[model samples]
Target: MSAASPLRVVCLVPSWTETLIEAGVNVVGRTRYCVHPADRVSTIPVVGGTKDVNWEKVAAQTPDMVVFDQEENTQAMADSCPYPWVATNVTSVQAMPAALEQLAKALNCDALLHMAERYRAALAAPVSRSGRQLPLLSDKHNSSLSVLNDDRPLLYLIWRKPYMTVGTDTFIHSLFTHLGLPLITPGERYPEVDENWLVQHKPVLLCASEPYPFAGKLNAVKDELQLDALLIDGEPLCWYGIRSLRFLESLQSS
Candidate 1:
C-alpha cells in the first residue's frame, strides 16, 4: 500500500529500461532489447523498441509509472501515457547513473540508492592501481594532432545501417577524451562513412560499439582495412545512468 511497494512500471527504451531493471525496480513493461536478467524481463510486457512503441498495448497495462529516454520516445507516446513518466536523455557514459537514481526515486525503490552510490564510487576509482602517474586524454593539447584539431581523433561507430557514430561533444567522446583517446569524427550526428573515408583518416583507434551490435562487424572491418581496433560494449560506454554503477564495477574488475 506504500510507495515503496512495487509500482507497475513500463520502460519503453532499451538503455533506460535496462537501467531500471538493473536497479531492482519492477518493470512490468519494457522494450525488446532489455536482455539482462533475461527471465525476469521476459515475464514483462513488450512495448516494442526505443523508436517504436505500442501505445495501445501499453495503455492496456495501465502502469503506475512509465520510463523512457527523452531522445528515444516520441511526443505522442509521452502524451498518451496515463501515469507519471520518468524520461531520460543519455548521450554519454557519465550521465547514466544519475538517470538510474532518478528512476529509483520516482519508483520509490530503496535498492536504487545503493546502485547510485556504488556507481559513483567506481567511477571515482583511479585508472591505475600501480601508483604510477597516468595521463588523461582530455589534458592533451588540441593543436598537436591533425584531423578534428589534435584532440586525439577517435571514432565511435555505433550502428551500421546508416553508419551512425557519436560526435566529440557526446558522452562517449567525453569518456574517450578522459582516457586520453583522440577524436576523428566531425561534430555532426553519426555521419555515414565508406571504407575509403575510414582508411583515409588513418585513425589511431577505431572504437566500435555493441548497442547497434557492432562486435563482429569491427573484426571484418579491421581485417579489410588492416587497422588495429577493439570492439567495446556500447551500453557501458553510452548508457549514462544507474546501469553505469554496474558498468564501473565491470571496468574495475577487468
Candidate 2:
C-alpha cells in the first residue's frame, strides 16, 4: 500500500478512531460509539459499535481497509468484509505512538508522519522534568516500583463494581515508572478491591478518564471514593495525540 492511495478506512475503536483523525487519515466509516471532539464525528457515517456492527453497510461502502482495536472492537466485524482489514490492541501509553505510526503506514498516509512524531515525542518528553518524585499506579500489578512502599498508591478503576485497581505489567505503570514514581496498585487492568484498601493507601491524586467522563463530578466522586486526593484529567495519562504535548508542558507548572 502506498501513501498516495486514496483509501477508505473504517475505525471501530472510539479512541483509535480519534487517533486516526488526529493523524489525518481519511476515515470513511466509524462505529457509533467512537465519539470525541463532537464536532468532527457528529455527522460522520454511523457504522456499528464494538460488539455489533453493520457489516452489510460496511461492506457496501467498499472500504480500502478496516482498523480494529481488539480491546475496544472485535475481529468478527471485519471478517468477510469486502476489503482488507487490520486489528491492534495497545495496552500502554508508550506503545500508543508506535501503534499510531504502524496504523499510519497501514493506511498509507505518509502525511501523518508529523502527527505521529509529535505523539511519540510527548511519550518521551517526561525524561527531562525535575521532580521530587511522583506516585504511580496502573491497570496492572506486581510492579518494579512495588518495592517502594513509601510512595503514594493510586488505583485506576476501570469498573465500579468489585472496585478494581491497576496492576503491574501495564503501560500506565511503565509511564509512571519513568517519572520516578511507584506503582502500588494490584492486578492487571481493573480488578475488584475495597474502600478499606483505598482509605488505607489514600493516593494523592485520582485520574478520571473517558469511556466514563469524571470531569464534572470530580469532587463528589472523590468524596464518595473515600480517598483524600485531587482528581485530574485522565487524558494526560491516557489519551495519545498532539494535545498530549500540552499535557506534558503543563506537568512542570502543575
Candidate 3:
C-alpha cells in the first residue's frame, strides 16, 4: 500500500519496526523488543516478542499485514498467523538493500525505496580503514592487550554462561566479513562454546553489548577466560534494515 493507502502492520522484527516507522508505514502493533525511534514506537501496542508472539494481542490490533524475519520470528508463528503476513530474510550485507527494496515494493513506501537506494550507494562506496583500531581491553585491566590491527581470527560473543557466537551464515558474521575481520567459528548458526573451547581455539574475543549485556560483565569475562576481550556495539553489527544503511555509511567514512 502507498502512503496514501497505508496498510496497518504488526512488525515483529525490531530492526524492521524502526525502518517501517521511519518510512511512515502505519505500524499498529510491535513486539516488546522493537524499541527504536523510542518516541514513535511507545504508542504502538505490544504483541509479545520475536519468539513468543501473543496471537490474541496481535489479533486485537486487527492489522492489515504482519511482518516477520526469517532469523527473528519462528516459522510456526508465520504459518499460524491468521492474517496476511510477509517475511524478509536478510542474511548478509549484500542482501540488505535488496531486502529493503522488496519490502518497499510490498508496502509501497517511497521513503523505504529511497532508503534502499541510499543503502545501495553506501555499499558501492569504497571502505576506508584509516588505520582505526578497536580497543581490546578496558583501562582497569592490566594486560598487554591492545587494539586490533592485523588480520587475526576473532570470535565474537553474543551471550555468556556457555558463551554463544554467530556462525558464518548469520547477518552478524556477514558484517564481520564486511569489516575484513576473519572469524574463527564454524559454519553452523549460533554455536555454544565453553571455557575449554575458548582455551583450545585461542581466538581474539569480542563481546557484543546486547542480547546479554556483555558490556556490564566485560571484566569478569576477561578474568574468567584470561583472554583479550573487547566490548562491541551489537546494534550496528547485528541489526539489519535501515540501521544497516547507517552502518554502511559509517564504514565508508572509517
Candidate 4:
C-alpha cells in the first residue's frame, strides 16, 4: 500500500515494529517485545511474543498485512498466517540496506526507502578517529587492557547456565565481523557451552546486555571463568533496521 492509502499492518519483529512506527505506518498490532518508541507502541495491541503469536488476536485486528522475521518468527507462524505477510531476513550487516529497501517497497513507505539509502551511506562512510569498534575487554582491578588481535578468537556470550554463544552465521556474528572482531565459535546458530569448553577454547569473552542480562552478573562471570570479560550493549549488535542505522550514525559522529 502507498503512504496515501496506509495499510493496517501487524509487526512481529521488534526492530521492524519500531521502523514501521517511525515511518508513520498504521501498525495495528505488535508483539509484546516491540517496545521501542515506548509512547507509541504502548498503545498498540500486543499479539504475543516473537515466537509465540496469538493468531486469534492477530485476526481480531483485521490487519491487511503482518510482518515477520525469518529468524525471530517461526516458519510455522508464517505458514499459519491468514492475512498477507511479509518476511524480512537480515543475517548480516551488509544485507541491512537491501532488507530495508525491500520492506519499504512491500509497505510502499518512502520514509523507509530514505532510511535504507541513509543506512547504505553510513555503512560506506569511513570509521571515525576514535575507532569504530565495540568496547574492548578491560580489567577493573588492573590498568592493562586486552588487545584484540585478528588471529585470536572472541566469544560473545548471550545466555547463561549452559553459557550459550552465537555461531558464525548469526546477525550477532555479522556485527562483530563488521567491528573487525574475529569470532571463533562453531555451529550454525546459538550453541550451548560449558566451563570446560570455555577453558579449552580460551577465547576473549564478551557478555551481551540482552537475550540475557550479562551486565548484572559481569563480575560473577569473570570470577567463575577466571577470564576478563566486557559487557557490551546487545541492541547495536542484534537489533537491525532503524536501531542499527542510528548506531552506525552515532559511530560516524563519534
| Ten contiguous residues with the weakest lDDT in model 3 | 130-139
- How much is 247 displaced in model 3, in angstroms? 1.7
In angstroms, the error of model 2 at 15 is: 2.3
Candidate 3 — what's its lDDT?
A: 0.79
Candidates' TM-scores? Answer: 0.75, 0.75, 0.90, 0.89
Model 2: per-residue Cα lDDT over 1-254, one tens digit each: 44443787887877667767765677778988777757888867877988788878787667888888766665666575557887776776666667767777788876556566765665556454222233232322122443234455555554444455566665556656656554568466655667776677776444445445544555555557755433334554555444444555556455
TM-score result, candidate 4:
0.89
Best by lDDT: 4
Local accuracy of candidate 4 as per-residue lDDT tens digits, 153-218: 678889988788998788878866775565778576899877777788777677887889775588
How many clashes in each structure?
A: 17, 11, 1, 0
Tens-digit lDDT track of model 1 for 1-254: 23243887888876666656765667788888777567677788887777777878888778888886777778777876677888777666566568657766788886766666776677677654220121112211112223333333356667665556777657777666544453567555556666777768766444454656554465565565555444555665665554445555655665
Off by over 4 Å in 2: 1-5, 78-82, 126-151, 205-209, 215-225, 241-246, 249-254
Model 4 weakest lDDT span, ten residues long: 141-150
Residues 186-231, model 3: lDDT tens digits: 5578999777777887777788778888766878988888887777
Candidate 2 TM-score over all chains jointly: 0.75
Q: Rate the local accuracy (lDDT) of all candidates.
A: 0.62, 0.61, 0.79, 0.80
**Order of models, best lDDT first:** 4, 3, 1, 2
Error of 4 at 61 (Å): 1.9
Candidate 3 Cα errors over 4 Å, as ranges: 1-5, 129-145
